[model samples]
Target: MAAANYFESKCFLFFLLASLVVDGIVAAAAVPKQQRLDRISSLPGQPPVAFSQFSGYVTVDETHGRALFYWLIEATSVAEKKPLVLWLNGGPGCSSVAYGASEEIGPFRINKTGSSLYLNKYSWNTEANILFLESPSGVGFSYTNTSSDLKDSGDNRTAQDALIFLIRWMSRFPAYKHREFYIAGESYAGHYVPQLAKKIHYYNKAHSNPIINLRGFMVGNAVTDNYYDSIGTVTYWWSHSMISDKTYKSIMKDCNFTEEKSSARCDDAVSYAINHEFGDIDQYSIYTPSCLALTNGSRQHMRVKNALLHRRVSGYDPCTENYAERYYNRPDVQKAMHANTTGIPYKWTACSDVLIKNWKDSENSMLPIYKELIAAGQRIWVFSGDTDSVVPVTATRFSLGHLNLHIKTPWYPWYSGNQVGGWTEVYEGLTFATVRGAGHEVPLYQPRRAFIIFRSFLKGEKLPKSKRISLQLSFN
Candidate 1:
C-alpha cells in the first residue's frame, strides 16, 4: 500500500509540471506578436516609403475599458538594431500624434491642405524606432468606456497608466522588449516623462528581471516648475521687449511667482500682461508671426486662432493643425490605422480641452524628481528653444540653478556641421542645451539642429563643440 502511494505521488508531480508548462504556452500564445502590427500598406496621399508604420489602441485598464492610442514608426535604416524611443507631448492632455508626430519629430508632416502628407527630412525615426503615445485616456483617439476616468485623470494616474501601457506594449511587440529604450517629450512632458521614469525605476528594482530596458529621458521647452516657468516667461517677455517696463514692474510687484496657485491680484496682473500688454502675438514663440488668416467660422474659432498662432515660426504652416484635424477625423484614415474601433463621441483634436480643463493634479515643481532620477544614475537632458517665451530658457536656467549640481563641463557652443547649433552645459548628472532660432517646438523650427542634439543625446555623447567659434559665446 505504501509503495502504491509513493507511485501515485510521483505521477501527480509529473502531471502538475506538465500542466504548468502548458499554461505558460497558452499565456505566451495569447499575445500574438504579428497580429498587433498596424501594417500600413499606404497612407492616403502619402509618398511611398520603405519603412513600416503601425498605429492602434493598447488597452491598459480592462475593467475601466481604458485604451491609449499609439503610432510606432520603424527606423529608416537598420530598424532591428536601433533603440526604441517613446515620445509624449504635454498640455497634460495633448495628442502626441498630432503635435509630436505630425508637426514635430515624427517621420511625416501633414500638408497645409489637410489632404496629404510630406516627409520631414530630419525625422527622429531615422535615428531610432519612434513610438508616439496618446496617454491618460480621453486624449486624442485614446478613450475610456467609463466617463469618470476622464474626470479623475491626474499626474499619478497618468504615470501608472503609462507604466502599464509600456509593459503591455512590449508584450505585443516583443522585439522591443529587451531593446534599449528612452522616453522623450516636450512642455508638460517634463512632468510625465520623469514621473513615469521614476515608476519604471522602482519597478526595475523590485523585479528579478526588468521589463523595460530604460536608459534615460529628455524634455524640451518643458514646464519644470510653475514658479520658475511663470517668472521666466514674464522675464523673457520684458527682456525681449514684448512687455512694457511698466507691465513688467507690475508683474514683478503684484505677482507671487514662487507659488503654484497664484493670488487673485497675480492672476489679474498676468491676464493684463498677456491679453492687454502682449496683444495678439503668440505667447509661445514671441518672434513668430501670428496666424491671422484662420477664419474657421466656428464657436471655438478664436481659441483655434490663438492656438494655431503658436506654431513653429521659422517655416510656420498656419494650416497644419487644421490639416491634422481633418485627416484624423476621416473614416478612411481611422479604418486604415485600425483606430476609433468603438466609435468615440468627439472629433479628434490636436489638444483636448476636456482633459486640460479636467486635469486633477499637477506638481508645483519637478526639481525634486529630477534630483532623484539624477541620483539613480539615469541620463537626463533638458533642452530649450531660445525663442519660446512661454517656458523660456531663462526659466529652465533658473530651475536648474535650484538643483545646484556641480558643473561637469562649463557652458560651450555646440555645433551642427560647420555652423553653431546651440549652447550646451553639462552638470554632474544632467545636460542642458538651447536650440538657437527654435521656438517651443524645437524640431518644428530647427529640424537639422534638433536632429543633431537628439542623435547626440541617444549616443550618450556631448553636443559637438564648434571648432572655429570661441567658447566665450556660452552663457554664464
Candidate 2:
C-alpha cells in the first residue's frame, strides 16, 4: 500500500510492487552474499513437486546507491524451458512476497488468522518460474543504512533500478537470458509495470540483446490517468445509485483536470463524491457490491436461496485468510526480525503514505513502451476489474483509447458458468480483459478467473470470442 495522499484525496494509491524497505542496519559491516544465500536456502523446498529456488541481491541504481533483494521460484515441470513471469504487489512500500506471494499467486497461501502458510491449489508457480522482488531499500525486509539513500524516491529511479536488478538477476541465472519475460502487477503498478517495461525496452534496444527477450505486460485495476480514474469513479457512483444525479452533475462541473495541475482535480472530485454520497457519480462503494450488480441488465446471477444454510451441512466453499504470515511478520525469518517496529504498520493494509513517496513524482508512461512492443511483434495485455472504484476499469479503457488500436475482437462476455461477470476485448496483438466480481486485487478475489486469464497469457493465445458485444459507455 502506497501512502495515502489525502491532499489529492488519493487514497492508498500504490504503484503495485516497488519500494525500498528501511530496516535500520544489519550487523554485518558488509552485505554477506554467502549469508544472503544461506538465509534464502533455509526456505522449504518441494523438489519432488519440481520447484527450484534461487535468491540473490542486485544493485539496481548505483548513482542513487540503491539495490534490491529478490527470490525466484522455477516451475519444476518446465525448469529448463519456460516463460518467466515477474509479479509485483502495489504498496509503494509493501513487500511483493507479502501480497503477490501470500495473498495472490505464489506457491503458498497465508492463513487468514495471519498465523501460517498453507499449500495453494491455485498457485501460479504451477505454470512457470515466478520472481518476487523487494525493491528500493525500505520496504519489507530489504534494508539500507544510508538515510540519504531514502531521500527522493521517484518513479524514474525505481524503473532504472528495477531494470538494473533484472539484468543482474538474469546474469546470475544465465539460463533465463533467452526466456520470454512478462511483467504483471496490480494497483499502483499502473505506474511501475509500464515504467519498468519502458526502461527494459529501451535497454534491450540500446544493447541489442536478444537475451533480454521482453514479452508483454499485465496490470489489474491499474491507475493510468488521474483525471479519468477520479472522474470515472464519480460516474461509477452515480450509475450505481450511490449518489444523486444532481450531485453527479455538480461534481462534473466542479472537477477540472489540467496537465498543468498535478492531481488536485482528482482529489477534489473524490472529496466531492465522499461528501455527497456519490450523488449521480460513477464511483462505487469500496465496501459495497460493484456497479455490475446494478447494470448486468438482468443477465446477472441471483444468489442461490438457502445456499448459506446448505453450506453449513455440505461444506460449500473454502475461504482462508492469512497465507502471508509464513513469509511476512514471521518471528524466525531474518526479514521479519528486521521489520519496522515504530508504528502498527499493517503487513496488508489497503494504504500507506510512506510508500507513496516512491512515485509521487514519476513522469514515466507505458504508452510509448506499448507502441514499441507492438511494432516489435510482441503481444500485450491491459486489463482491470470492473468494480474497483480505486483504479476502476473506466480509467484503463480510457488509457487504452490513447493507443487508438482498432478493436479487432470488441468487448464480449468471458464466462466460467452461466454467469457473465466480466468482459474482454482483443485488438491486433493485444488482449484486454476485465474479471467480474473482482476488486483491486483481481487474482485474490477472482482466483479461477485470474488463472484462466494468466494461462492464456502464457500461451500467447487470445480469449475465445462471444456473440456480438460492445463496450458499455455508461452504467444506466
Candidate 3:
C-alpha cells in the first residue's frame, strides 16, 4: 500500500522538521517500580498483571510515502483468550505515547523525575492486549521528509493509513491476527477510531475474510455527533452548576450549536459557567476533581507546568487539571501534534480546535454505521464518564437518542466496591454504560469500574447488577 498524498506539502514538510529531545531524563533506579507493584498486589480483588513487551517500526506506503515510528506496549494475556485493543489519542496529530502510554491504560508510567517506569495499579492491560501507536508520519517520533505529507492527513486518508499500519503490524504479531480486534481511543479519535473500524468492516466484507475480526469498541467521552456535542457542553455546564441557568438558557437559545462557526456566546457560556461554579478559579482541576486531588500539586510534577501542558516532546496529556489553559495556550505542543490550527477561531482550552476544524458538515448522521454493524451481528458498546463536559453523557445520549435503540433491558446502576457508580442497559447486542464521578478518560478516572465493564464485555455477560439497586430499569 502506497502512502496517499492527501495533505502533504514542502512547506508543511518543513513544519515537520521539529525534532524531539528527551527532557529531564532521570536515572532508572530512582523510579519506584516496587512501590507500585507492592501496592498493586495488595489491592483487593485486583487482577493479576502480566505483559509481553514489543517495540518496532511499521512502514506503510501512504501519502505517496513510507510512514515509520516506534510501536510499544504489551499484548493481551495468552491464558485469558481476550481481545486485542489498538488504542490511539486524538490530536489528529498527537502522540499516543504521551497520553495513551503514560497517562492512561498502558502498563508503565514515566515517574515524576522523567526516568524509570512505575506500574499503574489500574492499567487497562489487565483486560486485553493493548497497542499504542504514534501516527500520521510526523506526530511525535514518527517522521517524514516530504512536507506535503502534512497536507494529506484528512479523516479518510488517516483511516486508510491506519488500516495499512494494522495489516503490516499484524504480520509482526501474527498471534493477534485471529484475536477479536477493537479500535478504541479518545478526543479527535472519536472520529479516528469509528472511521477506521468502519473501514476494517468494509474491507472484511469485500475480501470475504475476517482479517479484522472486530468485536466491539468503546469511546470514553468521545466526540461523535457535532451538534449534540456542542449543545451538550452548555447543558453540562449548567447541570454542574458551573453556569447560571439564565446564562445557559440564553446561550442555548442564541448559540447555533452547530460545529460550523465558532461563536462568542458559546465561548462566553462556558467561561461564565466556569467562573460561577468553583472558588479559587485559577487552580481548579479540569478533569474530575478526584484525579487532580491525588496529584497533590497544581503541576503533575514541578517540571510539569500544568496538567494540560502541551510541549513538542513532553506530549499530549488529557487535562485532569488546568484543562482551560492546556487546550488553548500550548503553542509548541499544538504545532508538533500536527493540529489543523486553521480550524480554530478563538482561544479554547478543551474543544476549541475541533470546533474550528474542517469537519464534515453532512446531514447524514453516524447511526448508519451503527445500524450496519448491528445488522451484521457485531456487538457494540458505547460508554461514557458522566462527569466529562467535553463529550458529556448528555451528548452521547443525544447522539444515541437519534438511533432510538429499542430497550432490551431497562437502565440500572452497575457496581464496583459495593457502590453504584455506573448505569448500564442492554439493547439488542449493544450495551451502554455511564460511569459516575468519571470524566473524559474513563479508565484513568475509574479503572475498577472500567474493569467490571470490560469483564462483562469479553464474556458476553449482561451488565453487572448493583446490590443496593434493582438490576432493571423501570421504563414505565
Candidate 4:
C-alpha cells in the first residue's frame, strides 16, 4: 500500500510539471493580436539575437490610404523595462531605415555586398528600444494611395501623421503604451523632432490621461532656425576653407537672412560654392570620402541623393547607403520584414526626390516651438557632430544662441573612456553638447561617444566629468 501511494504522488508531480511547460510555451508564443501580422521572425542574413524585432506599416490616414512604416528593435535586455526611443531621419524626404537603422544607430549594418548583415557594436538598441520610422507618405516603404499626397507633403502634415502613427502603434504594442518615450534624429530631423514633441506635448495636455508618455527629445546637427542655418552654413563653408573668401562674401551680400526665400543671386552664389569651390569632397562630412558609386559623374546624385549625405570611411563602410538600398530592395528581405506588400511601383531609394521637390510648407524657425516646450518643462537636448559642414556645429550653435537660455552647468569636457567624449553645457530647460571628431551622423562616426551621450540624455544626468572608470557606466 505504501509503495503504491508513493508511485501515485510521483506520477502526479510529473504531470503538473509537464502542464507548466506547455503553459509556458503557449504564453511565449502569444504576441499582441494587432502586432502578430507585423512581427518579424527574422531577416535574411540577420544574425541570431535574443530580442525580437517588428516592422510594418501603420495607416495614419484611412481616407487617403497613407501609411507610415516603422521598425521597432526591442532593447537588448529587459525591453519591457527600458524606454522606447523613436528615431527619425531628416531629408524632409529621407528614409529613417536607410540612414538611421542600416547605417547609424540600428542594430544591423548591411555588408558591402548588400547580401549579408552584420551587427553594429554600438547600436542604440543596447540601452533603449529603438523605433526607426520612415515618416511622411512618400519616403521609403511608407506610401499614400493618393498621388497628390506626395506633392503636398510638408512639416504640418508630417507631424500630424507621425503623431497618429505613435497613437495607433502604441495600441498595437500595448506593452509600451505608457512607457517613457523619447524622440531623436539628425539633420532635417532637427525640425521633425521638436515639431513632433510640441505636437505630443499639446496632445497630452488636452487629454486627461495620455498613453504617449513623451519624456524629451534630442537632435544632432539639426536644421533649427532657417535664418541661422543659412547664415551659419555659409560661414562654416568659408571658415573651414571649403569655399573661398570671395564666395563667402558673395553669399553674405546676396542672401537676405530675414527673407523666407533666398534671392536668385544668393542661390547663384551658393551653387557656385557647391560646383566651383566645394569640389567633390563630401559636404556632409568634409573629412570623409564620397561614395564613388553614387557620386561618379552622376548629376542626379549631385542634386537629389546628396540630401542625406550618408557616408563613412576608415573604420566604417563608405557605401553603406548602397548596401542599404540593395538589401532593403531584396524580395526575400522585404517579405520577411513585411514591407511593400502593396506592390509599390518605385524601387526603394534612400531619399524621395518627389517629396523633397514638393515640400510645400516648412517652418522658418523652430525657436517658437522650443520656447513653448521649454516653458512646459520638457527636456530638450541639442547636439552636433563637429565635422559636418552641411549642417555644421556652428549652425546649431548659432540657432541655439537665439534661445538665450541660462546655463546651469558650465561648459566642461565629458569623458567616455580615457579620452574626452565631448563638451556639454546644461541649460535651464535644455542641454547642448558636441561629439568630438564626429561627422554629420554622430553615432556612425563616434558610436561609443554618441551612445554615451544618448545614455546621459535619457537619464537626465550630466556626462561623466572625470576619466575615472568609476564615474562612467560600461557600455557595449
lDDT of 4 by residue, 1-476 (tens): 99999999999999999999999889756656659888899999999999989999999999999999999999999998999999999877889998899888999988888899989888889899999999889899999999999998989999999999999999888889889999999888888899999989989999999999998999999988878887787788888898898899998898887886667897787778887888877777788776666644321221211122323321255567878889999999999989999999999988887887788888888999999989988888988888888788888889888899898999998887888878888989999999888888898989988888898889898888887851446442
Candidate 3: how many backbone clashes? 23
* Rank list by TM-score: 4, 1, 2, 3
Worst 10 residues of 1 by lDDT: 299-308
Q: Say which candidate scores most in TM-score.
A: 4
**Per-residue accuracy of model 3 over 192-249 as CA lDDT, tens digit each:** 7777778888888788656678886666666667676666656666777666678878
Q: Quote the lDDT for 426 in model 1.
A: 96
Better of 2 and 4 by TM-score: 4
TM-score of each: 0.87, 0.74, 0.70, 0.93
lDDT of 2 by residue, 1-476 (tens): 23445633442233221121222234342444543442343343222344766554566655544557676777757667778988876546556766677667777665445554566676777778898877656555454455555556666767777787787777666668879898888766767787887788778778855567877788777766655555565666677666677767866775564343435554455455555563332222144333322232311110110010000000001222223433355545433333333332344322223554433464434566677778877767777776656556776777677778877877787754345647898987678898877766677667766776787788776653432221121100
Please give the TM-score that candidate 4 achieves against the real structure.
0.93
TM-score of 3: 0.70
Instruction: Please rank every candidate by lDDT, starting with the best.
Output: 4, 1, 2, 3
Give the residue spans of candidate 3 off by over 4 A.
1-50, 66-72, 263-365, 467-476
Name model 4 segments beyond 4 Å from true.
1-30, 296-315, 469-471
Task: Write out the backbone clash pairs for model 4.
Answer: none
Clashing pairs in 1: none
lDDT by residue (tens digit), candidate 1, 406-446: 99999988876667788999999999999998888898888
lDDT: worst 10-residue window of model 4: 299-308
Top candidate when judged by lDDT against the true structure: 4
Please identify which of the two predictions, 1 or 3, would achieve the higher lDDT against the true structure: 1
